[model samples]
Target: MQPGEPSARFVDIELEPGDLRLRTLVPADAPLLVEATSAEPGRSLWGPHPLGPHSLRDAQAALAEWDPAAPGQFSLGVLRDGRLLGAVGLIPERPGSIEVAYWLRPEERGKGIASRAVRAATLWARDGLAVPRIWLEIEPGNEPSLRLAERVGYRFEQRVPRHCRAWEHQDADRDTWHDCLIWTFGTGPA
Candidate 1:
């Protein structure tokens, strides 16, 4: 669906599976956002915007900028027992596709939280939004994210060179880029 479509309304929707609740992030989550992102600095570079919020004020600004109602694009807080664990974001890539990006707290990794959260979001995008393709762009060295993508049904597609602008090289006179492993959902292992 295109932006502003009637079915793009996802701002108020909440995906609750078992004890996990995926809901729209709010300003109140700034502290958790800062805390979670601070544990691993590189986690910020995985999103569409390589530079993620680092301070509470920055987190608040990031939360405020997230528009869940904007067709096929949204960031949802992954909460368990009302406490923020991480976030799952669906960013529109094209007319019928979206990219799924997620990150969990350091302590929350390896507990199946990311898998469940991704599955929930993917299901929503597939059934709720009628989105046909869902994909992920993971850095090659990020083993955890690579494993999680496969475990959640996203198959490795290809590696695109210079897919993302290096966050650390933003000020360099010459361009510096990084490769990203593309993984797409709804296909068997490659």
Candidate 2:
């Protein structure tokens, strides 16, 4: 959707008392976001992004679309004590489904941060946005991410070939699509 066009879906959410807050990404978070996403681990998963060189502009662009007056495919910074720990977002991937994606800094791993963030965002999509189905698609080899999805009650729905081409740089040719395990929350697993 165009910027400023009303989608009326994404909304701010608070996860933990004052320690963890899921809120709109801000320009100040650009540098940290760039640093996090540019790492080999993150880059391999999210593919190449412009955040490294054009941090401010990139962050602004990321947040610009989610104006309070108009919102769609909103991204949130997972903040702990006002410092960005990671990011989680909900993007409308189909007519009746919203997809979830998340990442945390290496230093932030193993702390349950990703789990909390994903859980909060999924609940917001379900209760706040009244979303009927939430999807979490994981690359077959991403064991940690898959485990996190299971922890949040998302059950395996299906496996699809060539489901995630954007997840890797080599896949840019579209000839190396990775198999993905689709998991769902609202729609019970088969």
lDDT of 1 at 161: 89
Q: Could you give candidate 2's per-residue lDDT for residues 1-190 as a string of tens digits?
A: 5322345443557787767888766444567565555543434112245423335566556556534344446667787776777778667765557889887777788989889889988887777666778989898898899899999989888999987765334456754577889999886223
List residue ranges in candidate 1 displaced over 4 A: 1-18, 38-40, 45-53, 70-72, 171-175, 186-190
Clash list (residue pairs), candidate 1 = none
TM-score to native of every candidate shown: 0.78, 0.78
The candidate that wins on TM-score is 1
TM-score of 2: 0.78
Model 1, 1-190: lDDT tens digits are 7533634535433455457788767556778777767766454522434354467776776765665543445687788777778888877777677789888777788999889889888877777777778899998898999989989988889999878666565464565778999999844233
Q: Which stretches of candidate 2 lie over 4 Å from their true place?
A: 1-10, 26-32, 35-41, 44-54, 64-71, 166-175, 188-190
Per-prediction RMSD in angstroms?
Answer: 4.0, 4.2
Please report how far candidate 1 places residue 102 from its true position, in Å. Answer: 0.5
* Candidate 2 lDDT for residue 155: 88
Please tell me which predicted candidate would have the highest lDDT against the true structure: 1
TM-score of 1: 0.78
Error of 2 at 50 (Å): 4.1
